[model samples]
Target: MSDTDKKTVIVFTDGACSGNPGPGGWGALLQWNGQEKEITGGAPDTTNNRMEMRAVIEALNALNQPCHVKIHSDSALIVNAFKQGWVDGWLKRGWKKTNKKPVENRDLWEEMLTAMQPHDVEWIKVKGHSDNERNNRVDRLAVEASRKFQQS
Candidate 1:
């Protein structure tokens, strides 16, 4: 591909959990032009949503510039938060729910926004276990990471 035709960046991310509050893992695949990179990590005790947020945060942090980015994920919670503008509303309200309770995962949400500030991002939701090869790969990597954490 010519320089002008090269894709700036594309990322696929997923998170896996052995249990809601058990071992968790996050996986991310970053692609730019003809290059591919993968990142994965796990926590001994955590929630799936935290892992999901971490995947995006780490993926964005991997980039050195404010390049255009496309992010693919299977987590409805993450996808809808951005798509429906819920995240903006949450931040505007100081990360509080309508009922006055603190929003869950606020720290990660804020971190993700900060990491994303330099990029023009487009979030796309992909069906899990479908034909998207990259997404599936990240999903499996997340599960593997989770298993490794559990074993440790």
Candidate 2:
């Protein structure tokens, strides 16, 4: 199908960190029709929020071209940032928050914004560690990736 005619892709993403700032990882699952793709990566030392943002940035980057995409994430930090206009406000204020503090995860947020610019994206928030199958799956993937970075 042509890009314009393609079905809206559904994405589920999650991030995990063994010690909040140690051995962090991100996981994403993308589905369009019957086709699915799983993407994951980790950093030996990172914050959970950064990993969360990376999950989304990587998912959007994996798309071949601009298309309608719906992203479901278990992070309010990720969801509210967009749904509540924090990102736009940050951009307008030179990446500072209303209190004039630099936004945390500014780099990942910038990367995510750029990655998402080419697509029509809808962000959906889902409760973490709940009954949501896809969310749970990605969470497991993220945890697994995080464990890989743990000291052996």
Predicted model with the maximum TM-score: 2
Q: Which stretches of candidate 2 lie over 4 Å from their true place?
A: 1-6
Please provide, for model 2 over 25-73, each residue's C-alpha lDDT reduced to its tens digit, 9 standing for 90 to 100: 9999999989999999999999899888999999999999778899999
Worst 10 residues of 2 by lDDT: 1-10
lDDT by residue for model 1 over 1-152, one digit each (tens)?
33344347999999999999999999999998799999999899999999999999999999976777899999999999999998888888999866778899888998999998878788999999899999999999899989988864
Distance (Å) between predicted and true CA of 64, model 1? 1.3
In candidate 1, clashing pairs total 0
Candidate 1 stretches with Cα past 4 Å from truth are 1-7
Measured by C-alpha RMSD in angstroms, how accurate is candidate 1? 3.1
How many pairs of residues in model 2 come into backbone collision? 0
* Decoy 2 TM-score against native: 0.95
- Sequence-dependent TM-score of model 1: 0.91
**What's the lDDT of the predicted structure labeled candidate 2?**
0.92
- The Cα local distance difference test for each model comes to 0.90, 0.92
